[model samples]
Structures are given as structure tokens and as C-alpha cells.
Target: MTQTEAAPVTAAPVDAETYAQIVQFYSHHMQLLDNAEAEEWADGFTEDGVFAQNVKPEPTRGRDTIAASMRRGVDRLKGRDVVRRHWLSMVVADRVDADSVRTKYYAVVFETPAGGKASVYLSTTGEDTLVREDGRWRIRHRLINHDGA
Candidate 1:
């Protein structure tokens, strides 16, 4: 209980339940995109939130625009009937507040073609962000900075 022994905790460690929800929210986003469920993917954000890919010059904002942008991309791959599985591990979470948390995790996407036995590498993130809204966790912003060339 000594003052010197206490390092004066500045950031609170995210609890297991909250941590799981954050992970689930991120996984859901990946699933929506993989399934080409554009609208569902956009719905994961807040009304005015954004989804931005750092590789792209512009970021997608608002639900309608986000959905449309995603739709365009999804349309390109729609015919392929591809499925992507997200691998999330090495998660690190920092508490912004009691209700808000910022989590960073390593992720890799494996693309599987319909009726195909082999899988191909699609993308790997730099990271993503999630927020708690309406007592439910959802992705408020995603800044996917892919490194794989």
C-alpha cells in the first residue's frame, strides 16, 4: 500500500468480458466484409463514424456512403464466392474511459474460393478500433494499414 510502490496507474486494464466483446465486434466486421455484406458492415459504425483504409487517399463516412463504397469493392469479388477467415491474436487494449476502450490486435485474412481446396493470403492489418455504443460493442473506426505487398 506504499505510495512509492504504487506506480500511479494511468491506463486501466480492460476486463476479460469487455475484451471479448471488442474482439467479437472486430471479428464481426471482418465477417461482414468477407461475406460481402456491405450494409451489415457499415451498420457496425456509429451514425457519423468512419471507416478508412490508410492505403486509400480518402476515408468513407456516414452509413450510406460507407455501404456504397463497400458495395463497390464487394461487387468486384462477389462472383468469386470467396470466404475470408480472420485470425486475431496478440490483442492489447487500453481503456479510454470506463465505457470506452481502444484495442489493437494482429490480424490476417485467409481467402478461400468456393469449391476450392486451397486458400490464399488476402490481407493483413496494421490495426482496428472499436467503441462501445448502446451498451454494445461496435467498430467505430477502422484504419486498416496493410503491409503485405
Candidate 2:
């Protein structure tokens, strides 16, 4: 295959380069959230992306709304001098189509107050539908469920 041609994304497993790219994508994506860059983090999603959690009555739809929701939480934490971090691990990707991937992973969230020790805030699992937009991976839909709930 030529360098420009993508290796097929299959049920067995993606090639090393493809897997590395997925890991790199999540690393940068989560770091943005950890750093409280809400708008930029939300930009990792498609324009009509959806985020749904088990605790919420309804899913947050649209990239703009997702950013707004994140902003509210970040602002509230900042008021109390607290910082939140998200860690995603155990990622497994399945090719949904030529252009889309479904990733499932474990997530742990930590919160730290100014001069205080960090504590686990939440433990969950996330399944996301990812698509390439403009040659970048963007979330099209995300579903997160609390570990014990």
C-alpha cells in the first residue's frame, strides 16, 4: 500500500501507527479538559456532537452546548480554588466504517483543592463514536456511565 493510503481498520486490530494515533488523540483531548480549556476541549467534538451521562436527565447535544456545560462546572470549581483532571485508560477501538471508529475506555476523574491532596471524584466507562473531520478525530457521540450506578 502507498504511504497516503490508510490501512484497513478491522475487527482484529488496527496497525501500530493507527493505534498510536488514537492514543495520542486521547492524550491531547483529555489534557485540554484537565487544563480547564473548555471551549478548546469541546472543539474536539463534531458540531452536532452529543454527550450523555447516566446521571443527567438528558444528553447535552451540540458542540456549543457541551462547551457551555463544561464552562459552568469549571467556573464553579474555580470559585472554590479547585482543579479537576480526567484520566482515560484501557482504550479499545473498533472500526465502525471507513471513516468512523468506536472507542471504549475507562475514565477516572480527580479533584484537587488549592494546597490540598487530590481525591477521586468519579469512576466511569465511556463509549464514543469518533469520526474524522478535516483530517482530525472528533467525537460524534459519547455515552458515559458511572461505575457503580
Candidate 3:
């Protein structure tokens, strides 16, 4: 009889590190949107992924659709300057599988008029599903649930 020592094995990967990456990505995304960099923001998603502004309606599929929706919003506020901010918090990401993750977060958007006369607010919470493709993570689906009228 012979006995051999087994090879050293690493610990099972925790979801925390991956969740942190997703949180960082979301922060970057918020910055991009705040700067009105729609094209850059749209680049965060996969080719066939979706961005849903509202939960009731179907998501805006593809980068083109997402970009177009962003463009329309940007164009609507063209002349009159408006600054928008997205406050995201309480991000919860779970590893659904080896290459898939699900996350939930709350978003509060505040907007100020050019003259600073009045401020408008809209808040929503969202569920996001992400997938790792080619060693990179991209948002696969997003569903936003608005909290107000």
C-alpha cells in the first residue's frame, strides 16, 4: 500500500469579489450617464442585452436601441441645461451560476434645472442579471421598478 499527498487546492471563490466589481462598474456607469455620455454608457451592456427603463414594458434591446433611447432623452433637454444624478445603493448580487450573476439595487435620480429654480426627483429600484462572456462581465438584463408616480 502506498499513500500520496493531495495537491493543494484553493478556496471556493466567494461572490463578494465579483459583487464588488459589479458595484464598481455601476459607479462608473452612473458617472458616464451623469456626464451625458450615452454612447459610453450603452457600451456597458452586451450586444444582445437589454436596458429596461420601466418594468411594465419590454426592455430596449441591443446597444443601438439603448443608445437611441438615451439620445432621445438627451435631445429633449438640449438647450435648457439640466443636470441629472443617479444615486444607487444597497446593491445585492448573487452568483446564480458559474458564469451568471443576479443583482438588485435602488436608484434615486435627482435633477436640477439650468436656472436652479426647481428640482425634480424620481426614484426606482432595479434587478439586474449579468453574464460573464469571454472573461468579461456584461449586463444581460435590467428591470427597473419605479417607486413613484
Q: Quick one: ranking by TM-score, best first? A: 2, 3, 1
TM-score of each: 0.79, 0.88, 0.81
lDDT of model 1 at residue 19? Answer: 76
lDDT by residue (tens digit), candidate 1, 57-127: 89887778888888998898777687767676667777766666666667777777888865657555544
Model 2, 1-149: lDDT tens digits are: 38665444345455577678778988899999878899999999999999999989999999999999998977877788988888999988877676788888899999888999999999999988889889888999999999888
The most accurate candidate by lDDT is 2
Candidate 3 segments exceeding 4 Å error? 1-14, 115-120
Count of clashing residue pairs in every prediction: 0, 0, 0
- Native-vs-model 3 lDDT? 0.77
Residue 146, model 1, lDDT: 71
lDDT of 1: 0.71
Who is ahead in lDDT, 2 or 3? 2
Cα RMSD for candidate 1? 5.7
Tens-digit per-residue lDDT, 39-128, candidate 3: 888887888888877544576889878888887777776666888888788876776678877777899888888778545478898878
What C-alpha RMSD separates each model from the true structure?
5.7, 6.4, 9.4
Output the TM-score of candidate 2.
0.88
The better candidate by lDDT, 1 or 3, is: 3
- Model 1, residue pairs in steric clash: none
